[model samples]
Target: MTQFASLLLLKTVLLSGLALWLSVVVVNNLTAFRGGVFSVGSMMAMQLFDQAPAISTPLLSRRVTSEGWHRLVYGFVVIVEIVVALLLVYAALASLGAFLGYADATAAIGYANLALAGFVAMGLIMLVGGAWFAYYIRQEGAQITHFALIGLGLAAGLVINIPTP
Candidate 1:
C-alpha cells in the first residue's frame, strides 16, 4: 500500500509537469499567432521549409539575416522538450514498478525523490528555455513567455521537496 501511494505521487508529479510543459508550448504558440508574425499554418510551412525564416519584406530587406539564429533557438527548445519528455517517461515507469509491488516501499520512496528531482530540473530547463524564447519573441516584436515558465518552476519546486514515504 505504501509503495502504491509513492507510485501514485510520482505519477501525479510527472503528469503535472508534462501538462504544464504542454500548456507553456501552447501559450507560446498562441502569443506568436497574436503578433501576426505568423499563423499556425505559416509556422508549419516555415518549419517544413527547413525552418527558414519567412521571406517577408522586412526580413528580406535586412542585409544581415537572423534566420539561422532563429532556427538554432527553436532547435534548442525542441531538444529541451524532448529531454523533459524522456524524464517524465522514466518517472512514469518507476512509478509503475512501485505500484506493481516489484519494488520495496523504501526504494519506491527513493525513486520518487529521484523523479521529483528530474521534474525540478526539467522545470528549471523550461524556465531557461522560455526565457530564450521570450528573448527571441521580443526581437520579433512579441511579448515575453515568462509567466508560464515561472509558474511551472514554482510548482516543480513544491513537488520536489514533497515528503516521501
Candidate 2:
C-alpha cells in the first residue's frame, strides 16, 4: 500500500479501537445503572459538592443542593452516557465508510466531532465522579482506578481523532 493508504488504514484502526473502548465503558455503565450503582455514585459525588466543592463542584448546581438534584443529575448522566455511546458507534461506522471509499474527511470528521465531544464529557465525568468525589482519597472506592483509566481512554480517542494526511 502507498503512504495515503497506510494513513487511511491507521485512521480506520484508531477509530475502531476508540469505538471498541467506548462500547466497553458504556456497557459497564449500563451494568452499573442496572445494579443501582450510579445512584450511590451520584450521591457520593454530590456529597463532595457540599462539603468539598474545593474538591468537587458541579457546573450549575453547586449551590442549590438536594437529593432531588442528585437523582436528577444521575438521570441526566445516564442519558448523556447513552448518547455518547451512540455517537461513538456512529463515528466508527463513518470511519469504516472512509476506509471503504463510501465516506470522506467531512463525514468522518462530522461523526468524530460528536464522539470527541462525548470523550471530553467522559473524561470530566470520571474526573468529577472520581477525583472530585474523593474516590482517590477513599481507601475502599473502586472508582479511583476506573476514573484514571476512563480519562486515559478518552484522551486516546482524541489522539485517534487527529486528522491524518
Candidate 3:
C-alpha cells in the first residue's frame, strides 16, 4: 500500500479506537445509572471537601446539593458522550472509505476534525465542572483522567493531520 493509504488506515484505527472507548463509557454509564448519578452528586455536593474542613468551609458555598441538578448533569454528560461516540464512528468509516477510494481524503479529514473537536470539548466540559466542584482538591485520579483524555484527543488529531508529502 502507498504511504497515503497507510496514513488513512492509521487515521481510521485511531478514530475507531476513540469511538470504542466512548461507546464503552456510555454502556457503563447506562448500566450503572444510579452509580453514575451518585458520582456526579458527590462531586457537585463537594463531599470530598468534608475531609478538609479548614479549607473547604469557605468554599462550601460552591456545593450543589440538589439531586435534580446532579441527575441533569449526569444525563447531559451521557448524551454528549453518545453524540461524540457516533461522530467518531462516522469519522472512522469515512477514513476507511477514503482508503478504499470511495471517498476523498479531505472529507475524511474534515469528519475526523469534527469528531476530535467534540471529543476535546467533552473533556473540557468535565474538567471545568470538576474544577468548579474542587475535585482536584481530593479527587486527584479523576482530574488526571480528564487531562489524559484531553491529551489523547489532541495527540490523535496531530497524528491524523500530519502532512502527506
lDDT of each: 0.48, 0.62, 0.91
lDDT, candidate 1, 1-165, per-residue tens: 575476466655555566456557645644563332333223323332333553333322223235454455455554555555555555555655655656554554455455445545655664554333332332332213334444654575455445555
Decoy 1 TM-score against native: 0.48
* Residues 45-117 of candidate 2: C-alpha lDDT, one tens digit per residue: 4444444334443442423345565566566666766777677778778877877778885678677777867
Model 1 CA lDDT for position 25: 63
The TM-score that candidate 2 achieves is 0.64
Cα lDDT, model 2, residue 154: 67
Sorting all predicted structures by TM-score, with the top scorer first, yields 3, 2, 1
* All candidates in order of lDDT, best leading: 3, 2, 1
How much is 91 displaced in model 3, in angstroms?
0.3
Error of 2 at 20 (Å): 2.9
Instruction: Give lDDT for model 3.
Output: 0.91
Estimate the TM-score of every prediction: 0.48, 0.64, 0.95
Give the residue spans of candidate 3 off by over 4 A: 52-55
Off by over 4 Å in 1: 1-64, 104-145
Tens digit of lDDT per residue, candidate 3, span 1-165?
899889888888889999998999999999999999999999999887767454635677889999999999999999999999999999999999998999988889999999999999999999999988888888989999999989998999998798665
